[model samples]
Target chain A: MLERIRIVLIGTSHPGNIGGVARAMHNMGLADLALVAPRCEVITQDSISRASGADHLLHSTQVFATIEEAVADCTLAVGASARSRTLPWPMLTPRELADRLPSECQAPSARVALVFGREDSGLTNAELQRCHAHVHIPTNADFSSLNLAAAVQVLAYECRMAWLSQTDNQQPASDPGDTVRPVTVLEADDELASHAALERYFEHLERVLVAIEFHDPDKPRQLMARLRRLYLRARPEQMEMNILRGILSATEKAAQRKHHHE
Target chain B: MLERIRIVLIGTSHPGNIGGVARAMHNMGLADLALVAPRCEVITQDSISRASGADHLLHSTQVFATIEEAVADCTLAVGASARSRTLPWPMLTPRELADRLPSECQAPSARVALVFGREDSGLTNAELQRCHAHVHIPTNADFSSLNLAAAVQVLAYECRMAWLSQTDNQQPASDPGDTVRPVTVLEADDELASHAALERYFEHLERVLVAIEFHDPDKPRQLMARLRRLYLRARPEQMEMNILRGILSATEKAAQRKHHHE
Candidate 1:
C-alpha cells in the first residue's frame, strides 16, 4: 500500500522544503517522491542537510515537467489545497483520503498520488481541476499557513495510519475462544457508507427537496453546506442511507400528486 | 486549546532538528515549546535557519534541566514513543490523543505537555513513567523510525485538528428549524472518562481482581495492558465507569462470601 502511494510536489520553491519533504516521507516509510517542475535546486547541500539521513530519497527522486506527467499512472490523484475555490471540488480530510486508499490500491500495480502545490500560491484552479479530489489538512483557521514539509508529514502520517488499519484487518484473530470479555467494546460493526454512494444520495436528496419546494435551488444559502457537515459527521451506513433515499422518494411522489390536484 | 499544548523536547541532539521542531510547532499554531537539557546549542545558526519564519517560537522557547521540571505544572503529560516498553503504559494513537485533549484543556490555565525524547534513543523508562499517558504515531511497522521534527509535525497537526473540531462545535447553528435531516451522525453525547478518574478505577479494579483470584497479580502477563487498551479504546463515560466499578465490587464481595463458605 505504501509503495502504491506517490508523493508529488508541484513547483516547490525552496531546496530546504524539498529536503524536508524527503525526510517526512522517509519517516513514514513512503519512498516514491516526484517533483513537478520545481523552481529550487533539488540536489543542493541545504536539501541534503535538511533531509538528515533521508538524502537517498533525493538521489532517486523523479522530476516531472507537469502534475499530469507526474501522476499519469495514478488511479486516484488527491490535490492538497488550503484555499477555497469558486467551484468546490470533492473534498476529503487527510484521514478520509487515507481510509479510501487501501481498497482503491488493492489491485496489483494500482497507484495513488498525493499532490502538493507551491509553498506560497498553492495549486492553481486548472491544476486542482485536473485531480480527482481535493484534500484539506484542517489547521488553525486564523493562522492556517502550514510549512510544505509539515503538510506532507501530516498526510504521510495519515497514510501510515490507514496502512496500519488495513494490516490489522488482515491479521488473523489471536484471541482464545473462551476468555474474559472486556467490560466495554470499542467499535461498532456497521460498515460506513462510501464517498461515491453518499454523493449520489446527496444529489438525489437535493433534487427531491427542490421538487417539494422545501429549499429554493436559486437561493440556496447554507442549506447544502450545513447538510454536508451533518452527514459527513454522521458517516451513515449504506442501509441507513438507503432508508433516507426511500423517504425522499416517497416525499417527492406525494408532492407531485398534490401539485397535479392543485 | 492550542496555546495550552506545550511541546517538550528532551535531550535533543541536533540543533537543526530543534529548529525544525520549532518550525512545525509554529506552523500548527502551537506557541509553547519547551526543551529539556538539549545536547546542542539552542541559539545556533542551524536552529535559526531550520526554524525558517518561526524564529519567534525559538526566541521565547522555554529551557528546562529535566523532564520533571518541564512538565511539573502540566495536568496531562503525553510522552511520544515509537518503541514498546516492557511495561506498556497507557497508549493512544495520535488521533485518539487529540480527541481526548479539548475537554481536558477547557479549564482556564489547564496545561498539557506533549513530550518528545532524544533522537538516537527515546525517552528513558523513568521519564515515560512520569507521563500520564503515551502517544504513538502509527508508522510503517518495518521502518518505524520517524524524524523528530516530522513526529512533532504529526502531533501538532492532530492537536490542530482537535482545536478546530472544538471551535466548529462552538459555532452558532445557522440552519432553519425545518430541513432535510442527515441520515447518519457521528459523535455520541457521552463525555469521555478522564485520565485521573480512569487511573483510580484501574487501581480499584486490580485490587478486586486479586481478591477474587480472577487474575494472579504475582506474574501478571499482559492482563493490565490488555485491559488498559480496551478501556482507552472504549472511552467510557463517567456513568459507565461507575457501573463497571460497581460490578467489580459486587464480584469481589461474592468471591469473599464463597471463600468463607468453603
Candidate 2:
C-alpha cells in the first residue's frame, strides 16, 4: 500500500511545509512523496534541513509539472479539503477514508494518489473533479483551517490506520457470522419465546403505564406513540425484555392488592 | 477502562523508560501510571522533561514498594511479556488481553493493572504469578525483543483500541441478547453453551449418526462425547444451534429417501 500511495502536494508555496510533509509521511510509514507544480523549491538545503531524517525521501521524491502528470498513473485519487466543494465530491470522514483506500485498491500496480492543494487557495473544482473521493479531516468547526503540513500529517496518519484496519478485518475470523444481532428472535413454543409471544408482555406493560398516570385518556395516541418509540429506541434484547416484563408483572400484582384493600 | 488502567513498571531500571512509558500511556488514552520499586530515581526534572506533555500522569503516578501493593486493588492484572512463561497464567495475546480487561471490569472505580517487568529480564516467574493474565504482544519471532516504551506503546494501544471498541459496541447493540445479558453472561455464552441445549441437539443428531453408521453401537456414547467436546470447545452461538438443527433435519430426510429407495 505504501508503495502504491503517492502523496502529492499541488502548487505548494512553502518549502518548509514540503519538507515537513516529507517528515510526516515518514512518521506514518508512507515514503512516496510527489510534488505537483510546487511554487517553492522542494529540494534546497533549507527544505532538506527541515526534512530532517526524511531528507532521503525528499531527495528521491517525484516532482510533477502539472496535477495531471502527478496523478497520471493513479487508479484511485483522494483530494484533501477542509471545506466543502461546490460539486461536493463524495465527502469521506477520516475513518471512512482509512477503510475505503486499502480494500478498494489492493493491486501493487494500482497507483493511489492523495492530492493536497496549495496552502492559499486549496484544491480547485477541476482538481477535485479529477479525484474519486474527497477526504475531510474533522477540526474545530469555528476554526477548521489547518497548515499544509498538518493536513498532510492527518491524511497520512489516517491512511496508515485504514490499512491496519483492513489487515485486521482480513485476519481469519474465528467464526463466520460471529457478529452479535441486536434483536432476539425466539422461535415460538421453544424454551425461548419469539417476538410474537412477547405481544402479551407489551400489552401488560401498556396497562401498567396507564395505571402509573403516565398515560391519560385525552393523550392516549400520543402517549402510546411515545411509549412505543421509547421501548423500540431502547431495543431491549431477549433477556432484558424478559427481566423487564417480570418486574412489571410483580408491580401489577402489588397494585391489585392495593385495590383489594380499597 | 481508561480510568482503570494503571501501567505499573516492575523493577524498571531506566528513568528514561519510565518517562517514555508515561508518553505511551498518554498516547493510548491511558492514565494512572504506577512505578513498582524502580531502580532509578523517577519523577526527577530530566524524567519530566523526557515526558514532554505527559507530566500530569507522572505527577499523579504512584510509586509502590512491592508488586503486590501496586496491584492489590486491581480487579484485573495483566503482565506484559514477549515470550511464554514456564508458569501458566491465563495466556492472552495483546488482542485477547485488550478484550478481556474491559469486559471483566466496567466500574470506573475498579482497578486494572498492566505490569511491565524490568527492561533486561522481563517479568519474573514469581512476579508474573501475581498477575491474573499474561499478555504477549505479537512481534517478529526472530526479533521479538522490544524497547520498554515500544512494548508499553503496543499494549497501551491495544487497551485504548479495546476501550474504543466497547464505545462502538455500546452504540445500539441491535442484538437484544447483548442489551440485557450482563457482559459476563455473554462471555460465558462465548465460552460454552448450556448443557441442556447441547444434550437436546445431540439426541436429534444421534439418529443421523445411526443412519450414517458413523459409530458402532458399542462406541456410540464415546463418539457422541467427542462430538460434544468439539462443539462445546467451539462455543456455538444461537444461530449456530439453528444451523446444526437444519443439518440434522437434512440428514434425517436423506435417510428416509434411502429407505424408500430400498
Candidate 3:
C-alpha cells in the first residue's frame, strides 16, 4: 500500500526541504517520490547532507514539468493545503485520508498521490481543484504555518499507521486462539459507532425526549447539547449504542401508553 | 500549555539536526528547547540555515550538562524511543501523550519535558527508566529509523493539537443561545478518571474478585490483565468509574451472602 502511494512536491523552493521530505518518507517506508519542477537544485550538497542516509531516494527521484503529468497515473490525488480557500472542496483530516487509502488503492493498478505545493504559497486554486480531495493538518490557528517537510512527515506517518492497521486485520497474531494472554496495553477497539449512526441516534433520542415532555423542543436549553457532549465523550461502541437506543424506545412506548390513559 | 513543554535533545552529534529540531519545535509553537551536552556547536551556520526562520529558538536555547539538570523541574518526563526494551514501562502513543498533556500542564508551576536521545543510539536504559512514561511513535516495522528532528516535529504537532483542543473547549463558538447549530465536532470531555484513581480502583477490583472466589489469588491468569485493557480502552469518566465501583460492591455483597448461606 505504501509503495502504491506517491509523494508529489510542486515547485519546492528549498533543496533541504526536498531532502527532509525524502528522509521523512523513508522513515515511514515510503519510497515513491515525484518532484514537479522544483525551484532549487535537487542534487545539491545540502540536500544530500540533509537526507542523512536516504540519498538513494534523491538519486532515483522523478522530476516532472507539471502537476498533472506528475500525478497522471494516480487514481486518487490528494492536495495538502494549509490555508483555507474561497471555494470549499472535499476536505479531510490526515487520519481520514489514511483511513480511506486502503480501499482507494485496492485495485491492482490503482495509485494514490499526495501532492504538496511551494513553501511560501501552497497549492494554487487550480491545482487544488485537480485533486479528488484535500488534506488539512490541524494546527494552532494563531501559528498555523507548518514547514513543508514537517507536513509531509505527518501525512507519511498517518499512511504508515493506516497500512499497519490493514496488515494487522489481514493477519492475526501468532499466539494460539485460546491462550490466556498477559496484561498487554491495547488501543481502543475500532468498533465504535460511526458519525452518521451517532447522528441518527441523537435525533431519535431528542424526538423521544420531546414526545415524553422531558424538555420542550421549542424552548430547548442545553439539554441536547449536554447529552451530545456526554455520549461523544463516551464514544460508545455498537452494543452500547444499541442498549441506549433500546432504553429510549422502551421509554417512548411507556410514555405513549400513559398519555393514552390520561 | 505549549509553553510548558520543554524539548530536550541529549547528546546530539550533528549541528544541522539540532537546528532542524529547533525549527520543528518552533513550527509547532513550542519555544522551550534545551540541549544536554551537545557534541557539536549549536550556533554554527549549518544550524542557523537549517532552522529556516526559527533562529530565535536557536538563540534562546538553554544548554545543560546532564539530563537530570535538564528536567529537574519537570513533573512529567516522557522519553521517545523507536525500539522496545527488556524492562516494561508505562507507554503511550504520540496522540495519547498529547491528550494527557493539557491536564498535566494545567498547574501553574507544572512543567513537562519531552527528551530525545543521541542520533546513533537512543536514550540509555538509565534515562528511559528516569522518565515517568515512554512514548513510541508507531513506524513501519521493516524500516523504523526516523530522523531526530522529524520525531520532534511529530510530537510537537501532537502537543499543538492537544493545546488547541484544550483552548477550544474553554472558549466555544460565537452564540449565546437559540441557534440551530450544525453538529460540531468535539473532543472527549475533560472529566476522565485520573491515573491515580484508576490505579486505586484496580487494586480494589482485584481484592474483591479474589474474595468472591471467581479467580484463584495464587494463579490469577489474565483476568486482571484483560480487565485492565478493557477499562483502559473505555477511558471511563469519573461518574462512570463510580458507577462501575458501585456495581462491583453490589456483586461482592451478593457473593458474601451466598458464602454465608453455604
All models, DockQ values?
0.11, 0.02, 0.12
Q: Write the per-residue lDDT of candidate 3 for residues B218-243, one digit (tens) a residue.
A: 88554555445345445555666665
What's the best-to-worst order under DockQ? 3, 1, 2
Q: Write out the backbone clash pairs for model 3.
A: none
Better of 2 and 3 by lDDT: 3
lDDT of 1 by residue, B1-262 (tens): 8889999999999998898888888877899999999998998998998787788888899999988678766767889988547655556677777777777676665678899999989899767766667777765444566778889998998887676565443323421111221222214445445556666677787786666454577887656654554354444555666655654554454445455555
Please provide, for model 3 over A51-163, each residue's C-alpha lDDT reduced to its tens digit, 9 standing for 90 to 100.
87788999999999999999999999999988548788887778678889889978989899999999888899999999998888876445566778889999998887677
User: Model 1 residue B261 lDDT?
Assistant: 53
Q: Given candidate 1, what's the lDDT at residue B114?
A: 97
* Strongest candidate by DockQ: 3
Question: Residue B108 in model 3: shift from native, Å?
Answer: 2.8
Residue lDDT tens for model 2, B179-239 = 1222332232222223345456767876756664454567643445434433433334444
What shift in Å separates residue B60 of candidate 3 from its native position after superposition?
2.4
- What candidate 2 gets wrong by more than 4 Å, as runs, is A1-105, A111-262, B87-89, B165-262
Worst lDDT run of 10 residues, candidate 3 chain B, spans B174-183
Candidate 2 interface CA RMSD, Å: 20.9
